[model samples]
Target: MAFRRDPKTPAMTTDLPQHVFRLRVRYDECDPMGLVHHSNYLRYFEIGRTEFLRSSGGRYREVEEAGLYVVVVHIDCRYRASARYDDEIDIVTRIAKITAAKIIHEYEIRRGDEVLVQATVTLAVIDKTGRLQRVPEALLT
Candidate 1:
């Protein structure tokens, strides 16, 4: 899907369209060591994706209502650093590529200027019967 800018929102221009979702690491999302749990980074990526879609004037619910579902087929996450509880971080998400039935997204979890984690995720579209389906053309733009 192409990123659409909202006129009222402040924008950042980049080579690849991206959305930055910022949040603080909550206590419940952290481990006993006060560091964010590894699993929580995936959740952050999901939030980033959701916000990215919303900001681009799209919604997952709308896709589902159209009888199409996007399911994650692959994910590759690399952790470079640890984030402590209460740390404010930004999850940068971009659409890396799109195919007939698959969309690839790249993400970076950054605490200020330091990238704590990077990931790539692939999602495939499917119909209600769970059969693979090509992504709708309307959703591409």
Candidate 2:
């Protein structure tokens, strides 16, 4: 997703095709110390992936209804900074790699270019019966 920057703000472009999923840190996702709970980063990664797919002309539900689902097989998150309640964060995500049955996505969570978290996730396409399946070509397009 693109942020609506002030007209005076210069834009930065990159070769990496990515989606920016932005959200505010909610009270329920924060700890007593006002820092976001560590686990919530995983959720942000997922949101990043989902939005990336959607914005790129794919939909998670469409694939699921066709008997395919992307299941997280592995995840690694590195916290670089802490986020507290009401902090607006942008999760930048891209498809790092794709294979017949699996795909990898990379993510970086930022509060206006200051990365607060970075993560990588591996996902596999599987059917309801747990049989491996190929990712739809539409998703790769």
Candidate 3:
């Protein structure tokens, strides 16, 4: 299926205002129908989110080891197209909002000019006890 260009923005443009990460759709990620399974899209989003934090000088493991955790409190995604095995996709992540104890990220998954999925995720920072805590100061800068 031909992918659609999101009217809101061009897909996979180099000049996007936020971090862009590339990912490949593995053969095993596809279902018997030869299309990526719906659940795998969330994994793609998680990869993007993890890379975003890594690019920002933080990794999930480090954050967790530091006695803090980021739990996804809410997430929503809109699928625009199907990605097949071996397709190279780009995931663009942007910080939509940041607060003392929560962060909101927006994502666009694309293949060249075609957007396959778009999503917004909200995560909360908490300690091991699950009480909300402020995001680390270093990460906010």
* Residue 22 lDDT (model 1): 93
lDDT string for model 2 (1-141, tens) is 222323443322224578888899999999999999999999888888888888877899888889888899998888999988999999899766666677788899899979998888989999999999887766666
Scored against the true structure, residue 91 in model 3 reaches a CA lDDT of: 88
> Which digits, one per residue and each the tens of the lDDT, describe model 3 over residues 46-125?
88888877886767887788999889999899999999999999989887766667777889989999999999998899
Instruction: Please tell me which predicted candidate would have the highest lDDT against the true structure.
Output: 1
- Clash tally, candidates in order: 0, 1, 0
Q: Order candidates by lDDT, high to low.
A: 1, 2, 3
Q: Residue by residue across 5-49, what tens digits does model 1's lDDT show?
A: 445543312346789999999999999999999999999989998
Model 3 sits at a Cα RMSD from the real structure of 8.9
Maximum-TM-score candidate: 1
lDDT of each: 0.87, 0.82, 0.80
Where does model 3 exceed 4 Å of error? Answer: 1-17
Q: Is candidate 2 or candidate 3 better by lDDT?
A: 2
Ordered by TM-score, highest first, the candidates read 1, 2, 3
